[model samples]
Target chain A: MRATNDTVSSRIEIARAELTPIQFATGLLFAAAIAFVLVFLQEPLAHDAMHNFRHAAGITCH
Target chain B: MIVDYLQRGILAGVVAGLAYGMYMAFVANPLSEYLHDTQHEHGHDEHGHDDHGHGHGHGEHVHEHAEHAVSETTTALVSIGSGALWAIFLGGLFALALYVLEPALPGPDGIKTYVLAGAGFISVSVTPWLVLPPAAPGAEQLYSIESRLAIYVALIALGAVVSAASIAAYRRTATRHPAIGVAAGAVPIAAMLAVVPSITPTVVTHPELSSALVSAYRALAVLSQAAIWVLLAGTFNWLQRRADPATAVDGSHETLTTKQ
Candidate 1:
């Protein structure tokens, strides 16, 4: 029983250590995805909107 | 796991993007302009129309303009695509380095590994931008938007890969070594500096500025890139630390347990 408990505890610890880095890595991956969406989609949307607004406003003085 | 990856990826990506974007805006863009001007001046001299120079100036200007357009188009394709491609490659390299280095250091839970990965990614991503003149001459302003975006994407991808790989590798090693991580991260910067001359044009002449200005600008470009990478690395380190089990115990533990 003691051996089993030790095995279980060690397994848990191992699992914990393994998952910690994975968790952080996952965070980074997710962050990258968000950045992609922002750069590819969100920024373009904002840019188009701003362009249209400026056109309508006749702000082409430049 | 998916959500966590997405979150961290996006965070690191945005931070990397901003850092890269600023470098592009202030340094790379200016350097490209200088290169373009010099190229045009040389072109004019090559034609040897000293007597009719004024008359041909306008024609030369138009030709320069066309050249600028072509350069811009090509640069857009190369800079964006190549930048992203290199970022992914560099990320893998950083991870591999960390994996090899992790066993030799002393620490707890691979904090060092994570730090090293972050630093390595930042250094590699920023170094090329600093050293390599804009891929295309003359159209810095035109291609800046597209090229910068591509580079940013690449930097973000690189950071994500490096961070993920290093962390994964470090976890497997029995002895936790943070120094290995730090050293791994620092190695790439040294490597980049060593190779800068080979990859980048040396002693470029500029029509707009004296030799001193060119040198000063080049130096500034390097400093700006280094500063940007340092900021990026610091941000990633802070994020990792915040997410580390030892630091933010309650919230991170809860998150970890729920995931388990």
Candidate 2:
């Protein structure tokens, strides 16, 4: 049990160190696209579609 | 894997979306409609329009009332539908944040999800609200829409940075000087809450309307937003566990991922 715990912690450290640039970029792109649609899109129809949810989430919609 | 993250995100989104829609339809919608009506009435009074006889016969007025009811139903349905879509998108964002931050986040797997979700709420909702409390319909706007949007976006970025820094600080000192980390995290948020509200004041456009109603709506807004974040985090963590039955048994996320 003691050895298993040590191995688990080390493995976690390895995973932490393994986050590559590609994965980081992919996550960033996905996040940015979603944020734009949900918060920053200003086209009238799109804006209207998201208006109530934006207001509920306190996103500065009129 | 990236696909796994997206799948988990979409699934979590679906759950949060439904809950958000239902909450809006049942709890928040009525208050919003009341505020809308109050604004309409206030506008009519200002314009000196007759309450019942503004260019419509009594029969026409009845017809109009029926039409308004129909439209209200449609509005409620549309709002709920759109709300679900919005929540789903937010869930996608939540998943992506988790993907990026999971390795670096402190605590065990389950606790990490909650921490990320709490940070998300602060980044996206709570911090923006410090500058601009969730406005009930008909609240007077002190800034142009563009200006308000700019400030909101800036505040969200600031909040995200502060949250990330706080997490990093906590992780660095958690075993040694945890109190320092806690203070480091709390002070910025406390300062923002105290200073921002005073700098950016919101005016009540219609004083005659019930203040209680506005307060109720704002309160509900806060609760609903918080609920969505919590649901998204819970659902995401549940899915992660389901994917790794070994972890489900041992509560260890590191074992399977490292092997992969």
Candidate 3:
């Protein structure tokens, strides 16, 4: 039982390591795309977003 | 084996992305636009509002609009383009996660898709929203952007962890006591939600107009996400079933892929 558990755990670890590239690419893809959205639309959208709050209090975000 | 998963993931991701993206283009975009129009007519400041709880995009992009003179078609196309990218990104990641856990997951293609998509919905939308409620055009912004973002990311991570653990726990306990397994499935999410405080309790942007608008906004947000998950799951299942019937692994072969 103990040996079996160790092997299973190791297999899972190996699988995770093997998947690192795919994981990394996916993360990078999402990060870039999201960044693009923010950068591209920030000008007008941010203005409308921040217009009404009193005191311009808290974090000033565009 | 990994290659097989990657192929399936990409294929399903693209198909589902297109479907979800189309829905956004036709259905979601117009809905948000209508809401914006209505809100403006209400005599409240005519600022833009976000669809699907994303406060950033819905606002007016005045400079770009003015400088570019972007027509409605161009705007719609841009929205579709970005929407497709988002769908692809999210769908691919979701597929990868599901494929990774495929070995341990039981059930047929249909069950598996529902579980994966539902858990995803919970992780991505439901859980995070508990902490950082959707921001509208004029909600009182009490928290700093940096702090709010940090906490929001943390909450999202926490939600993902809880969701994964819940799914795993359900899998384990399910074989022993089915009822216990069900309860176990819910325990982690309940605990997490209870422990986490709301990022901002909220201040009414417009006392009279705020309630109705916010309510509609939130409801639409939830509806949009629910539609995405449903469509994604269905589309992925259909593509998988079409590619190779034998490898249809989400649910059992007993049910039709499209039905589930």
lDDT of 1 by residue, B167-193 (tens): 455444433565655455444445544
TM-score of chain B of 1: 0.42
Summarize candidate 3's per-residue lDDT along B15-96 as a digit string, tens digits: 6567656765676556544543454567333332422232335332211111123444555555566555555666776776
The order of the candidates by TM-score, greatest first, is: 2, 3, 1
Q: How large a fraction of the reference contact set does each model reproduce?
A: 0.00, 0.31, 0.01
Instruction: Using DockQ, rank the candidates from best to worst.
Output: 2, 3, 1
**Residue clash pairs of candidate 3:** B108-B250, B108-B251, B108-B252, B109-B250, B109-B251, B110-B251
Instruction: Please provide, for model 2 over B1-260, each residue's C-alpha lDDT reduced to its tens digit, 9 standing for 90 to 100.
Output: 54577689989999999998887787666666766676666554332222232332323221111113235666667678877876898888787667666667766778878898889998998888877788765555556567777888898998898788778768766777768767766766777678877886662233445778667767888888899989999999899888886776554445434655
The CAPRI class of candidate 3 is: incorrect
Q: On a 0 to 1 DockQ scale, where is model 2?
A: 0.23
| Candidate 2 lDDT score at position B188 | 63
For each candidate, what is the lDDT? 0.41, 0.68, 0.56
Off by over 4 Å in 2: A1-52, B45-70, B177-184, B203-208, B249-260
The number of residue pairs in model 3 that clash at the backbone is 6
Against the native complex, each candidate's DockQ, computed on alpha carbons, is: 0.05, 0.23, 0.10
Task: Output the worst ten-in-a-row residue range by lDDT, candidate 2 chain B.
Answer: B58-67
How high is each candidate's TM-score?
0.39, 0.76, 0.65
Query: How high is the lDDT of residue B7 in model 3?
Result: 66
